[model samples]
Target: PEEQFEPDPSKKNLVILGTGWGAVSLIKKLDTENYNVIVISPRNYFLFTPLLPSCTTGTVEHRSIMEPIRSITRHKQAAVKYYEAEATKIDPERKVIMMDDNSDVKGTANKTEVPYDMLVVSVGAENATFGIPGVKEHSCFLKEIGDAQQIRKKIMDCVETATFKGQSPEEVERLLHMVVVGGGPTGVEFAGELQDFFDQDIKKWIPEISDKFKVTLIEALPNVLPMFSKQLIDYTESTFKEEKITIMTKTAVKKVTDKTVEAEATGPDGKKTVEVMPYGLLVWATGNAVRPVVKDLMSQIPAQKDSRRGLAVNEYLVVQGTKDIWATGDCAVAGYAPTAQVASQEGAFLARLFNTMAKSEAIESQIHELSSTLNLKPGNPGEIATAIEAHEKQLRRIKDIKPFHYTHQGSMAYIGSERAVADVSWLNGNFATGGGLTYLFWRSAYLSMCFSTRNRVLVVVDWLKSKAFGRDVSRE
Candidate 1:
C-alpha cells in the first residue's frame, strides 16, 4: 500500500512491536499472504525467559534458549520483516511509529518511520527499581541474556577478590557475601543456582574460600514465593534453611550503597530497627515496570488517562484510545497478568482475526454457492440471503475469530539441583507443588521448550558433562 515497496497493493501493512512471546505468537499465527508483516524491537532474538535463571550459573548457556526472530517466522505462513530497533513513539493521528536502532558496540543505523494499517504493541516491561536510591547503579537485574552474563562475571569477580591475600578481612567478607532482594521466582531461583555453583564447583576447586562464601535472600513480605500455596512456601523455606542459605523476611531495603544494603525490619518484640548488611553482589529481581517509551505513548491519548500501567485495551486486544492500534503483554493493562502465556495467546488471537478479515471474501464466496439451498422464499432474496447466510457461517467459524482467552498452565521454578516447585493442573490434579522429582519435571519441560533441537541437544550434553566431572570452575 506504501509508495515504494508494494509487491501487492492489496496487502494490508501489519506492523508488530517487540519480539516477546506475544509478538512472536502474533507473527506466527497471522496468514501472511494477505498482509505485509513487520516486527520491530530493540532485541533481534526471542528469549525463553523461564530458563533464563539457569544461564547465570552456566548450567544453560544464554544462546541455548534464544531463538532468532527470523528463525521463528521462517516456516510460518508468512515471512515477517524484522527490524532490529526500538519504537520510540506512536503517532496515532498519522498512523506511524518513530523508531531508532540502538547502536553502541554494534554498528547498525537503519532507523526510519514505518507506516502501518494495523499495529500491535507487545513491548514487555523493564526491571522495576521503585525509585530506590543507588539500586539502578549497584544492583544487577536478571531480565535479559546480557544481564545474566554480567551476573556470572560479577559472581566470579567477588570470589576472586575475596580470596586475594592482600585484601583486608572486612573487604573479603563483603566480597564473599551474596545478597538477593525480592524473594520472587527469579530472585529465589538465582540464589539457588548461585549456591549450586559454589557447592558443586567453587567449593571443590577453591576449598580455602568455600566456608567464607554465603548467600542471603531478603523479601519484604512475611514469606517468600507468594504465588505458591502456604505448604509450598513453607517447604521452600525449610529447604533453604537445610541448605544453610539465609532467608530474611519482612525486610524492607531502604537503599543500596556500593557494597552494603541499608534495610529496616521488625524485631521479635515488635519494634522496627534499621540494619545494614555488607554484600559482594546484589541481584534486584523485584519484577517489572512500564518502560519510558510505553509511558510516552500512554500520555498521548486522553482515553488512556485511567490506564496508568500502560495503554488500555478492549477484549479484542485493540488499544482503547485508537481503532487501528492494539497492545498486548506488559505494555497493555489487558485484564491479564503480565505472563508469557497471556502474551502468546493474545498474539495468536490477533493473527486469527487478521486472517479472517483477509479471507472473508473467500468465506462469502463459499456462502454464495450455498445460497440456493435455503428454503426461504422472499422477494428481497439478495439482501436477506446475504445477512442470513453470513450469520449461519459465522456460528461455525466463531473459534477462528473470537476474543483472546488465556489458559493458565500453572507456574514452575527450579530451586537447586534436583529441587523445584510447580503449581500445575495438567497432571497431578490441581495445585500440585513439590520439590525433588518435580525439579526433574521442571528441567525436562524447559529443555523440551528450547527454541531449536540444536539447543536442546547442547543443553542435554552440558547437563551430562556437569554430572560426569562436576561443573566448570574456571572463572573465565
Candidate 2:
C-alpha cells in the first residue's frame, strides 16, 4: 500500500489558485517536495481553452480537452493537496485565504481559511459583457465546458423549434440566425465552427432550413484579428466572404433582447446607425473581465489601485506592493497579452524561481550550520572553511536568477471550411500565412498543446469521429 502523505511543518505552504493554464503549468513543473503545495480552485479540472470553441460545434468533445487536476497532482514527487472550492478573499496581512465550497454538495464545514507562506493568483478572467443590457440573460458565453454544452443544445433546439409545424417565415429566420459578437480569436473560431456545422451537416440533414441558416460575426473593431498582420487579416476576410459568413465590422452591440440584438454600426462616412437583428443564439466573446477575487485583492494593494486590467506585477511576476504574492495569466498585468502561451511561460518561470529560492535557502541553512560548528570546535577549520566557501559560491550562482521574459510564439486561428490563419514567428522573423495548410498546422499545433497524452489521443479520436460521422447534433 502507498504511504500516507502529510504536509511538512518545516516547509513553506505554497498555495496556488485556479486550475487554468498558468496554475496547471506551474504545478506540472514545480518541485513539490520543496514546499507544502496546496491547490485551491472552483474547477477541479484544467481545461484546454483554445480548443473550447471546437467543443461548441462538437468538433472536439469537452472531456477530451479536460485534464483532471488529480491526474496531474498524483504524479508529483510529493503529495499536493487540492481543494475544490472558490477563493473568496485574500488577506495579505494575515496571509490567509478565505474560501467557500460553492458546489452543490457540502459537509458541515463549507467556509474556511487556508494560510500560506506564498500565494499564486492565476485565476483566469470571466466573460466581459460590458454592462450590455439583456446580454447576461440572453447571450451564451464560450468560456467553460458547460457554456459549450449549452450552445450545442441551444443550436439544435433552435433548429427543431424553427422546423416545427406552422412556423412563421419571420420566426424561422430569427431562429436560424446565429449572431457571434467579438472579432477576437474566440469569437472568430466559434463562428467558423458553427458555420462549418451548418454547411457540412445541418444543411445536408435539414435541407428545409439550409438557405435560412446563417452565421453573422459582429466586431466593434474595424476588422477581426487585430493582432494578425494586414495581409493575413485580408486573407481571413476574403475567406469568410467565400464561406458565406457575414462579417459586420465597426459594429458595436449596444443591447440584446431574448430574440434580438441591437447594435450601432459606423459607416465609412463616419455616420453611425442603430440596427436591430433577430437571432436564436447570441455568443458574447468580446474579451475577459477581471474576476471579483482578483479585483478585491487588487483593492487591498495601494500600488495596484491604478492598475485597471488586473493585478500589476513586476518583471519577476510578484504582485506589486506585496512580497509573498504573485499573479499570473489573465489575472495579471504582466506587460503581455493574456494568452495561453504567455500564461504557461509565466507559470514555468515561477516554478523555476521557487525551486531556485528553495535551493538558496537550503544552502544558507547549510552554511549557517557549518559556521556554527566551526565556532564551537575551533580546531578543524580548513575543510569547513572550504566547504562554506563552495556553498556561498553555489548560492550566488543560484540566486542570480533573471527576471521573467515572454517570448512571442505567434498566433493561429481557425476560420472554418478546413482553412486557418497563422502569423508564425520563425527564424527571428514573422511569417504570416493563411489557407488549408495553415489549418492543418493549427490542428497539429493544438493537438501537441493538449494537456496530457490521454487528452491528445481523445482529441484526435474526436476529430476523426466527427469528420466520419458528423457532429453529434442531438440536443442534450
Candidate 3:
C-alpha cells in the first residue's frame, strides 16, 4: 500500500505552487494568521528576471538578483511550509495534490499526496519552440541562471577558440558569429550585451579576431521590440545600425542545424530566398512554451477547451471546473499579459482577497451562533434573509474578484553599457526617448529594485569592476 499522507487538520493549509513573481508576491502579502501556508516549487529562490541579460556578460552576478523563499516566508505571521517539489496532479475531488521530490519529471519513484484547503497554481510557462527543428538540440536558452552561465561560458569559448594559435579565417568567423532568434526584449538585450563585451574587452585583448566577430538578431516580424512604442522601436533600430549589430527582420528560421541555420526571407524583389548562415553560439528567445505538467492539468478540464495558453481561471483566479483551487501568473491564462509585473500584482491581489474572505467566514459563524443562542424573533424573515444576504454578498464579492489586468509601467531595455531605451509617459500626453540621461535613470531604477541591500552592493560592485578592469574573459 502507498503511504497515506494526511492533511494538517490543525490549521487551514494553503498550498501555492511556483516561486515566480506571482507566487512570491502572494506569499509576501498573505496574512498567515488565517491559515497554514505551504509553498511548492522546483526553485528555492525567486529570480528577478528583467536584469538577466546583464548576468550573461557578468555585468551582474546571478546571486545578487535572487531572493531565497525562506527569507520571504519568515516575513509571514506563522511558520510557512516549503516543499522543493513539483506538483504533478491536482485532485480536486480528494482535496489533495500529487507531488514528487525527484529532480525533473518523476517516473518510477513514488509520489507524495498532500491535502490542501486552498491551492494556488502559478507554475510558469516554458520556452515555446513552435515545432521549429534544431532549436531544442542546438540553441541555448535565456530563461534561467544556468542558461546565463552557459552563455557566458560559450562567449568565452567562442573568443578563445577563434583566436587559437593558427585557425583559418573561415573557422574563426564561424566560431565568432553568434546568432540570436526572436527580437523581443530578451534577444535584443542579450545581443546588445554581447556586442558591448566584444567592443569593450575582446577587441582590446584579442585583436586578431577583428570585426569578424558578429552578432545577428533574427525576428520573423518586420521590427524588433514590437511591444514598445514607435519612437522607442525606431530608436533601437537606429542604435543597432550604429552598433553594427545585424538585424535580420522579415526572416523566419525554418530549421536550425549544427554548423548552419536554414531560414526563409523575403527579398527587396518581393521574392523569397532561402539562406544558410554558419554560427558559433545560438540563443533562442522565442518566448515560452507550455510545460508538460501544466499541459496535463489543462487536459483534465473540458472547460479549458478555449484555454490554449494554460489553465482557464475564473475572476477569483480559481481554475474552472474546480473549487478551493486557484492559479496565477504565466501558468494560468489570467486574461493578462504574461509579465513579471502582472504576475506579482495578481498574487498580491489574491492575498488581500483571501484575508478578507477568511475574516468574513469567521464573522458569519459568530453571527449564526449568536442568533441560535438568543432564540429571539423566529418570525423575522427580513432579519434572517438580511443576515444571510450580507455574508452571501461577501461570498459574491470574493467570487466577483476581477480578472487580472496588466499595468504598463512603461518599457525599458539595456542596449549597451551606457545606453538604454525607455518608452515612458510624461506630462500632458507626452512620451520621449532620451538615451544619455535615461540610461542613468534606468541603471538607478534597476539597482534600487535588487532583492536586498547585499544584492544592491553586489550589483554595484559588478558594474564598477566591469567599468574599471573590464570583463573577465576566462571561460570557467
Candidate 4:
C-alpha cells in the first residue's frame, strides 16, 4: 500500500490565503513539517506580476510566468492540502474561514468552512476604478492573465476592424487609438510595450494604417513614474516624446465609454478643460483597491475602521487588534508601497517569525518537562539541570527576534526602443541610470527573480523567439 499521510493532530493548522507573491514567498521559506499547512486560493498558480505587461503584446507568453501552486507544495516534507477556491468570509471569532469554489465546473459540495489555528491573509488587491462611470464595463484591466489575453485579442480585433474595406477615416482612427490610463509603472510599461508592438510588428504587417496608429498615456499627477527620481522621470518623458507616444499629465479620467474616454485636463495657466478622446483599446492600470473579502474582515476589526486603503498591520505584520492572524502584500498597509519586492520581503519575514516561534515553543516545552523530571527523579538532577540550562540559553537567543524591517532594493521599469530605467541601491548609495544598458540589467534582474529555473529558461526563450521572428500576433 502507498504511504498514507494525514494532518498531525498535535500541530497547529496553518492556513494561507492566495498564491500571489507574498503567499508563495512565505510558502517557499516556511518549514511545512512544523505545521499542518493548508492553502486556499481561487487561482491554482502563482503569477509573476512584474512581467505581466509583456504578455499583453505577446512579447512574453502568459504561461511562462505562471508557476503551478501544486508543484510548489508537492516538494514539502509534509503533505500540504490545497483548495482552488475563493475565501468568501473570514470569521475571526469562530477562527474559521468560509470558502467557495467559484469556478464554472463545480461539484455538489462547493462551499465549506476550514478552521485554522493561524491564518494569513495575502489575497492581494483589485484594480481601483475610483467610482468612474463605465470604467469596469468598458475598460480592460491589466492585472491578471485573463486580462492580458483579452487585451491581446482586442488589439488584433481593433487592427483588423480598422483595416476593413471602405472603413471611414474617423472610425479607423478611433479603432487604432490606444489609450492607457494611470501613470504608474504598470501604465508606463504597458504603454511602452504597446507602442513597440505597433512600431515593430503591427506596422510591418499592416503598413496602410500605420500612420493612424497612436498610443496615449494619461496621468492625473503632474508627471509619470512619480516613484522614480527626477532625472529618470525626465528621461522617460523625453523618450516617450521621441517615440511619438502622447503623455497627458495633470489630466483626470472622468468617464469611459465603448469608443471614447472623457477627461478633464489642467492647463499651465490654471485653466481646466474637458475633452472626449476616442480610443479602440482603453487599458486601465490605476493601482490597487481593497478586495471585498478584505473589506468585510476590516469591518469586523475595530482597529481597522480608520484604515481606508487596506488592513493596517503592526510592526510585525500582525493584523491590528488581533493575534494569530497576519496580512501581507497589497492587502496590508505596512507603510510600504504595494510592490512585488515589498510583498516578498514581508512574506519572508513572517516565515522567519513563525519558524522562530515554533522553535521557541519546543524549547519552552522541553524546559518545563525537564524541570518536572528534576523534581520527580532526583538521581539525574545534575544532568537534567545542565540540559535545561542549555535549552534556556538557546531559547533566549532565538526569542529575541526583532520586528519586521523592509529594505528597499531598487526600482526598475521598461521603456520602448530597447531602453529602460533603474534606480538601484548599491553599496549604501543610489545608482540611477536609464537607456539600453539599463534595459539589459532589467531583463537579467527579472530573469533571476523568476519563481523557478524552468520559468527563467522559458522567459529567456520567449525573449529570444520574439526578437528573432517577432511576437505572435494571432488573436487568441
Candidate 5:
C-alpha cells in the first residue's frame, strides 16, 4: 500500500487542489516530469462556467461543457494521480492535507491525509447567500452541473403543474413565474436563457400557458452588471425590456420562503417598501464567498488574519505566512475580480515560476557536485572554471522569471432575444458593443474557450440542435 501511493524520492510532490480554471491551467502547462503531481477535487471534471447558464434551459447539455480530469492527466508526461475527494483541511505546518471522499457510496477509508512538498490551493469559491434565510433550502443555485439539471427539471415540472387539471388561474400564474436574484452576468444570462426557452420552445409546447409566463430579475444595486461598462449595462436593460423580462433595480431580497421571495424596493423618492413575490422557480446567483477549507487555512496562518473572502497571497501567488504553499483562482485575493480570466493567468504564472525554481535547484546541485569533484581531484582549474561558469549561466537564466501580471480581456453577457453586450479593450481604447453582432462574438469567444476540442464540438452540436429542433423540454 505504501509503495502504491509513495511519491518518488528523487522528485517533489506537487499537490494541487480543485479542478477549476486555475488548477486545470496549471496542470496543462506544468512539467509533470519535474515533480509528482496529484490532483484532488470533489468533481472529476472541469466545467466551462461561462456558458453554464445555457445548461439551465437545455440550450446546451451539461455534459457538453464538462472535460474529464482524467482526459487531462492522461496527456501529461508523467502519471498524475487524481482523487475524487474534497479537501477538508490544510496543515501548513506539517505540509499535509486532509481530504474526504464525499460521494454517497463510501469507500473503505473515506478520509485520508497526503503530504506535499509543494501545495497549490485552487479550490474555487462558493455561492454567497449573505445569510439570507431559506436560500440554501428553497432556491436553486447556478454554480454546478447538478444545479442546472435541477433547474431544467423544475422548469418543466412547473409548466406541467400549472396546466394540471382544475388548476385555478391564480395558481397557474404563480407556478409560471420564474424569479432570478442578482444582476451579475450569471443571473442576467440565466434569466435571458430562461426567457429564450420560454419564447422558443415552451410557448410552442404549451401555448395555453402563454401570456401568463413571466421572468423577473431582481437586483439590489441601482444597475445590473456593476462590472460592465455603462453602455453595455444600458444595452442589457433595454434588451431585457424588449424581451419582456422585468428588471427590478434597487430591490434587495430580505428572505425567501417556499413559494415567495420577500424583497425591499427603493423608489425614486428614496422610499423603501417591502413586497412579496411568488414564483415557482427561484435562481440565486448574487456572488461568491470563501470555502470552508480556505477559511480554515486562513485561521491557521497569522498573516491571513485580515483575509475575509479568501486566502491572502503575495505577488507570486505564494500564500502569505506559509512556505511552499500557493493559492490561485477565487480562493486567492490577488487584487483582481473572482473571474476565470484572472485565475488562468495566475495558474500560468505559477507554472513558469515552478519550472524556473526546479531548474534553479538542478543548476545549484550540479554546481555543488562540480565544486566537490574539483576539490577532491585537485585537477586543472580550467575544467573546474568552465563547469562552474556553465552552471552559473543556467542559474542566471532560471532566476529571470517574472512575477504574475493580470491582463483584462473583456466582459460579455447574453441579454436574451439574440442580443448580447461586450466591453472589450482594443488599441489603447475601449470597445463597447451590443446587440446581434456582439452575441455572435460572445458565442465564438466562449466556443473557442472550451477546455477541449471534444467539449467545443459538443457545445456547438448542442447549439445547432437547439436551433434546429428547439430545446428539449422533457422534465427529466
Candidate 6:
C-alpha cells in the first residue's frame, strides 16, 4: 500500500507569502515532505508576467498565462495548505503573520494569524507612481489580469467613440492617441502590442479612424530600455519609428488629467518646454515600488531602517538581523534586477537551502538517538560507533551548502512588426541579435519559460487564433 499525502504534526510549519514569480517558483521546486507547507496570497493563481502585454491587446488571453496555485500544491508529496488572503502584518518576534481575506466571498474567519517556524516573504512590488498627480486616477497599469482586461476594453471604447457620428477630427485624434509612460519592458511591449492590434484588426475593421490611431511612448531617461545593450536599444527605437510610434525621450510627465498629460519635453538643442499631450488611453509602467506589507516589515526591523528600495537581505537571501525569515523576488533588496528570471532563480535556491537544512536536522536527530542507545548499552559499542561515524559524515556533507549565486541568462524584448531584440549570454560572453529571427527566438523562449504545458499550449493557440481569426473586439 502506498502512503497517502498528509501534513506531519512533527514537521515545522513553513509559510510562504505571495503567489508571484518568486513564491510560485519556490513551491514548484520545493520538497514538501520535510515541512508543513502553507501558502498565503491574495491571488489564487500564479500569473506568467512575460506574455502579460499580449493580453492587453488580446494577442493572448489573460487566463492562458495564469496557472492556478492549487494545481501546484496538489502535486506535492505532502499535502500543502493554501489561503487566498493578503498578509497585512508580520510579527517576527512571535513568528506569526496577520492575514486578511480580501476576496468578495468572505467568511467570519476573514482575518487570522498564521504561525510559522520558517517564513518566506516574496510579496512582489506594486506599481510606482512617483507621487505624480492624476496617475493612479487616470492611467491603466500593466501588472495584473484585471489591468489587461481594462486596457482591452478601454481600447475598444476609444475606437468606438472615435467612430461615433458627428465626432470632430480633433476629438477623434485625441481619442485614438494612446500614451504609454515609462520606456521599460512593460511600457515598450505594451506599445508594440497596441500597434500590432491597430495594424492587424483595427485597420481592417475600422479603416476610417485607423490612420488617426497613434502610440506615443514617454521616457524620462535619454533612451528606452536602458537595461538592454545600446545596439538592441537602437534597434528597438528604429523598429518603433518604422511602426510610427512616437518616442519621447528625456521627457518627464509631471501631471496626468482626464484627457491631457502634462510633461517637460527636451528638444534636440537641449531646450526644455512644457507639453500637454491629449490622449484617450494612458498606460503607466514606470516600474516597481516597495509594497506596503514589505514597508511594514521593514519598519518593524531596526536593521532594515536604511533599506529604501525594499527589505535589506543578506547574501544568503535571509532577512538581515532577522532569524528564520527569508525574502525573494521584488520584495527583497538582493542587488539584482526585479525581473522574473532573478526571482525564479532565487526561489529555487531557497528551496535547495531549506531541503539541506531539513536533512541536517534529521541527521542530527538520528545521531542523538544512536548516542543515547550506546550510553544505555555499552556492549554494542562497535555497531553504535559505526552508525555515529556514518551519521557524522552525512551531517558534514549536509552542512556544506553553498551561497546563492545568480546566473544571468540574458534579456529579450518584442518590438512589434514581427521584430524583436535580444542580448543573450553566449559562451563566455554576450551575444546581441535583432530583427526577424530574434522575434521567433523571443516567442520560443517565452513559450518554453511558461509555468506549465497547459499554459504554453493555450498561449500558442491564442497566438494562432489571433493570427488567423483576429482579436475579438466585443466589449464585455
Give the 10-residue window scoring lowest on summed lDDT in candidate 2: 1-10
Candidate 3: stretches off by over 4 Å: 1-10, 104-110, 376-405, 426-430
The parts of candidate 6 lying over 4 Å away from their true place are 1-7
Candidate 5 achieves a global lDDT of 0.93
lDDT of 1 by residue, 1-476 (tens): 21233335677788899999889888877787788888899898898898788888887778877888877777665566778888998888898989987856555556779898889989999988889999999999999998999898899889888888798988888999999999999999998898898888889888988778899999998999998888888888988887778999989899999989998997778789899999999999888899888888878888888887777899888888789999888888888878787888888888888777767755665566556544445567777677766766784675356676777788887777569998887764777677878988888888876767977887888788777787665566
Expressed as tens digits, the lDDT of each residue in 194-279 for candidate 3 is 99998988899988787788999999898999988888888888888888899999999999998788889988787899999999
TM-score, predicted candidate 4 vs. hidden true structure: 0.99
Pairs with steric clashes in candidate 4? none
For candidate 2, write residues 27-61 as lDDT tens digits: 99999999999999999999999999999989899
lDDT of 4 at 76: 76
Query: Would you list the clashing residue pairs of candidate 6?
Result: none
- Which runs of model 2 end up more than 4 angstroms from their true locations? 1-3
TM-score of each: 0.90, 0.99, 0.90, 0.99, 0.98, 0.98
Give candidate 4 regions above 4 Å deviation.
1-5
Candidate 5: stretches off by over 4 Å? 1-6
lDDT for 312 (candidate 6)? 86
Alpha-carbon RMSD, candidate 5: 1.9
Tell me the tens digit of each residue's lDDT in model 6 across 36-136: 99999999999999999999989999999999998888888778889999999999999999999989999989999999999999999999999999999
